[model samples]
Target: MISVRVNGQRFQVRAASIVIHDGHVLLHRAADDDYWSLPGGRVEIGEAASATVVREMKEELGEAVTCGPLVHVVENFFDIKGEPNHEIGFYFQVALSEGSPLVDKARSYSGLESDLRLMFQWHALLDLGSIDLRPAFLRNTLSTIPLVFSHVVHPGADDV
Candidate 1:
């Protein structure tokens, strides 16, 4: 959870999960926020990106996940609470561990993480264009997901 300051802005390294099932994708938004995005958190020092996804899932979803191959590598520059922020994100394809009820249900559900009060939900993949997913690039990329991993660069967020 280290934050580095670069030219008065903040930079971070994060890992995200792209969990899809039955034509839907799993997304989460903080309780006070208005947009949806992948579920994951910052990568801890010394932790592998893949492991970060696994740990974040357990913390945010209260479920175990098995991370598959990395699908997208993104360099995102955005602003949070008026502060410029940048993140190097690793998006990995993931799934609920075997026997998890979520795997069987494959429908939208909401829950508040006890500590953060973050709300996790499932959204139909077909409707992603209407949602506000940060890094913005994802809005288009998710529809025709590439079989091979891709590199993405989001110059910056317009909200700044």
Candidate 2:
């Protein structure tokens, strides 16, 4: 039960990722790196939440995705050298209908036989729970807030 404290309130949220491919999530297992996480990074200065997602995906995956509504916001804290660090993460449901994904330069995962500089991989929906990830997905509520499931409401043929 790892948790974090935010502004004197204890919670846990350090990172976030939202990857959608063929109705499935895209997961990355770093070279020699354990734990499977979604493809995203930290939020930069003067960057909006929506923009951060776009930039992170481009930086890590090299794929451009159409971001939908804001999905999840998680608050977590970590202990760095006995010091507490705060991390508030936001994950969203995105549509990657454009460019192909690119892998970053590889470092640790050499034995996996991913010749690419960076390792590229995907995981099935069934395994999302078995993996150890910072932020979690495939849920209706996060951070105690109810997330509106946009995919649930599919329009008829007329809308298409």
Candidate 3:
């Protein structure tokens, strides 16, 4: 994991997948979290950000994905466990390979990675604002993913 603690603040580089189907987007969250986020994980040292998205999908969901173009580059500042945190996120369009059980959009799914339990769901893009999706800007931006790349900076809890 490309994560470090400096001056009591956590910094990490993350790569996430954005998978849309039938006007819905795939999202997931850890068992203990009240909000949902994209399906990917921390970028490992020496690994490309795009590769991290593919690897994380396989590791976390037991599903293979085809990584697509980079959609957004985000500088997100937030807090976790009373500690300040900063994250550099690479969001990429991705598609599940054929025969993926996770393709079902009618219901939610669950998986376990190591000791962490994860819940996966598909949420309608039109109703995104009604749910708790962190990096909060995503509620408005995801509905119209730009054709070209985009960069965003979310100040912190108060604004994002």
Candidate 4:
């Protein structure tokens, strides 16, 4: 991972998935945080964005996904705990086939990975706007998915 630090905060490259099933999307948020985001993680060295999404799905959801085309490329700039943070997120259209455990499980799941306990949740598209979905542009994009790959630039906190 090639991370740059600005005033003690790290900027990173991440990969996320737009896993929509039955009018709902799979979103993950840490138990300690109040915001929700896509189910993906940082991009490792030499790993393609699609591969990262697939790997993340397996690790986070315990299910396999067929990564589809690139949907959106988001340039997200925001502050975490008052520290400037930026991330380039590649969002792919990932599909979960029938019989996937995530498709029929409880709404909340907890797991211990990389020394952090993470929580994952599924939210209906209709309820997205009521929550704090990071990158802020994500909520709007989800409502009207773009036909072609588009870039979303969120400049600092005001943009959300």
lDDT of 4 by residue, 1-160 (tens): 6468977777999999898877778788877888998888888889998999898878866778899999988888778888887788899989886777777535677654477678877888878899999877777778665435888788645655
List ranges where model 3 is wrong by over 4 Å.
145-148, 156-160
Best by lDDT: 3
Across 1-160, the per-residue lDDT of candidate 2 in tens digits comes to 1244556554433234565554345656556556555555556556666776676666655567777776656544444346655556666766675554322222222212124234545554545566665433342232223345332211222432
Q: Residue 86 of model 4: what lDDT? A: 79
- Model 1, position 67, has a per-residue lDDT of 92
- Poorest lDDT segment (10 consecutive residues) of candidate 4: 104-113
- Give a tens-digit lDDT track for model 3, residues 1-160: 9999999999999999999887899999999999999888899999999999989888888888999999889999999889998999999999998877887889888867679999999999999999999889888888984535789898745675
Per TM-score, what order, best first? 3, 4, 1, 2
What lDDT score is found at residue 22 in candidate 2? 44
What pairs collide in candidate 3? none
Q: Where is the poorest 10-residue window by lDDT in model 2?
A: 104-113
Top candidate when judged by TM-score against the true structure? 3
Model 1: lowest-lDDT 10 consecutive positions: 104-113
